[model samples]
Target chain A: MTGRTRRPPTGAAVLQPHITSAITEAVLDELAERGYGRLSMEGVARRAGVGKSALYRRWPCKQDMVLAVLSQMSVPLAEFPDTGSLRGDLIAGLGAVHDWLTHPRFVLILPDLTAEAARNPALAEAIQATIGTPRRQLASAALHRAVERGELPAGLNLELALDLIAAPIHWRLNVRRAPIEPGYLEALADHLMRALGATERH
Target chain B: MTGRTRRPPTGAAVLQPHITSAITEAVLDELAERGYGRLSMEGVARRAGVGKSALYRRWPCKQDMVLAVLSQMSVPLAEFPDTGSLRGDLIAGLGAVHDWLTHPRFVLILPDLTAEAARNPALAEAIQATIGTPRRQLASAALHRAVERGELPAGLNLELALDLIAAPIHWRLNVRRAPIEPGYLEALADHLMRALGATERH
Candidate 1:
């Protein structure tokens, strides 16, 4: 009776890395093709060429699976490198934003996910926790480093600055669906430096 | 045959203003609740308490119907009022953007339409034509006036400047689902003036 009571659930096996990768690709593809609202577990499993049990082993439902894959890809993609100067850092950070928003699969998936998230508040909160907060923290750390180095005002509005830093690229690529012209990112970094009241030499 | 060709086609009757308003409200309500993909002519007709022929009388298809309703609401909303200085102009223009984006119906409808537009190229083009271009032209006229008034540089990058002016607020309200703090719009305007190299006094 004790042994039977202590037994683990049947589908609680460890996920294989290859299967995880395949599932990730399938989630993105499914999102791109059909969008978040229409995505189904069976569809993802079929696309990944994995059985239902394999998916249940990793994530119990579609939202969990999608969020996990998205978080794994997005959180690290937001890493703001230590480029020594605030200008260099802004360029590096916003450049990552540009690349992510312009990535072929992401270009399709993000807007759909955003639409879905707006409708589903729980999903919106989940996304904020998994992706938005962590990404903002990385960028915030970069700005904080700039403040310590005397590049920005100690009284800087970090919340507003974060929005200013990334919104232009996002607006251009995602909302406008426009191409980034040459020298645009460097100019954007310069504009942000001034916008944040950075004291660095031009 | 000549007389028949000269005669007007069926369903070519002029639209009633009250019926148009009802249909417009129904379209927005339907879009907010069900999104663009799931919206149907029959559903809209049923919701508006009008017959299907009324819709077909105004627009031959669903895409055209949606676009016309969206255009009517969105295009005029982008008007940029002249406030003499570039800073004032930016504040007024972006304040309008803030109002439009955060409007209860638009808050729900915009993201869904953006997602649908991303997937449908024809719809995207239609939106660009009816909403995006007209809105940009109004803002562009404001910038052109600013150049004339010597508030901004003669060589200002208008396209980038326009993107900068609106993107931050859009990002804060729509993408981040964050609130605008007190004095935020004035601070944003100041930052934009600096970003644009405005010669006006701070």
Candidate 2:
């Protein structure tokens, strides 16, 4: 065994990051073009200009690859701005959601992934853990700040309040495919504040 | 040629409704199991225990077939109750939505079809025309009644209100997969009423 000379790991080491990035981009493109149902490791590898072995090395299957890519894209976009008031904070937060959904990549990717997640429980779990929970937490933090400032009632239903903050915009843009008019977010924020019993402190 | 006796269209004519019903059920099952991307006329026909010609006789393609089936299922379910009060009407309307979504077939079919509609513009249009429009009309009627009864402001934003009524339940059940509590709908209705400026007349 000592007589056999081992090849150096230099080439594989050098190509790893590049290969990973290429595969990630390719997976997203494939998801955008063909959707999750039609996406395959072979197609992703071909699109990435890498061998299938490289893809298998990174992800065991298409679902894992998709989850990883979505997590990478979504988590970074979950930033919630701490505007001075609850109303300001909500408008800013929802505006971010609007921008994210309307972005070219997500416009194509979200619907497909949502549909896939419906049929695939494992993917749904990954989505909630990676994308859904973090986004809700950030929005919840905004509401918590409002409660602390006495802008909202102390016993406000936080879960329902979070749903209110995000659901309308999602339904309009994604479900109804309707356009959001200018000044919509501010109006929405006003309505949400009223719904949550937010009022000026005396 | 005219002398040849007509077969009286006995077998197919007699079996038309049964065959149509069978194919419709098959399409829903196929959508639930494989989703829209993988659904095919051939598979639907096979599942229905009918020939491709039979399916072709009814609809031109898969899109038309799916749309027809969904329309049949959705239109009947769009009935909204006149509960006399804005809050009551909203709870009733949203309760219907909740029931429809949680129904066995819809639970399986809606997510996949929604996902498919996102990718396919033509399908989206068909869905909006068939399923979306009627449901909105019914819900809107309830709100209009509230306005007439002076429950809500006359100049309230009906479009936004409509989105508010339906979006949260969907986000919870479908997007978040969270369970609604026993009194959740009533509580939600209260919040929505406040948000939409619905209050008792002077």
Candidate 2 is graded, for docking, as: medium
Best by TM-score: 1
lDDT for position A188 in model 2? 91
lDDT of 1 by residue, A1-202 (tens): 2335445567776556788889899999999998888899999999999998888988988899999988888889889999999998898998899887877788898888888878888998898898888999999999999999999999998888889888898888778777899999998888888888899675
lDDT of 1 at B16: 73
Residue B147 deviation, candidate 2, in Å? 0.2
Residue A63 in model 2: lDDT = 75
Candidate 1 lDDT (Cα, 0 to 1): 0.87
Per-residue lDDT tens digits of candidate 2, residues A80-171? Answer: 77877887788788888898888777787887777777777888888898888988887777788888988989899988988888889888
- Displacement of the residue A109 alpha carbon in candidate 2, Å: 1.3
Give the 10-residue window scoring lowest on summed lDDT in candidate 1 chain B. B1-10
What are the chain A TM-scores of the candidates, in order?
A: 0.92, 0.86
The alpha-carbon root-mean-square deviation between model 2 and the true structure, to one decimal in Å, is: 6.0
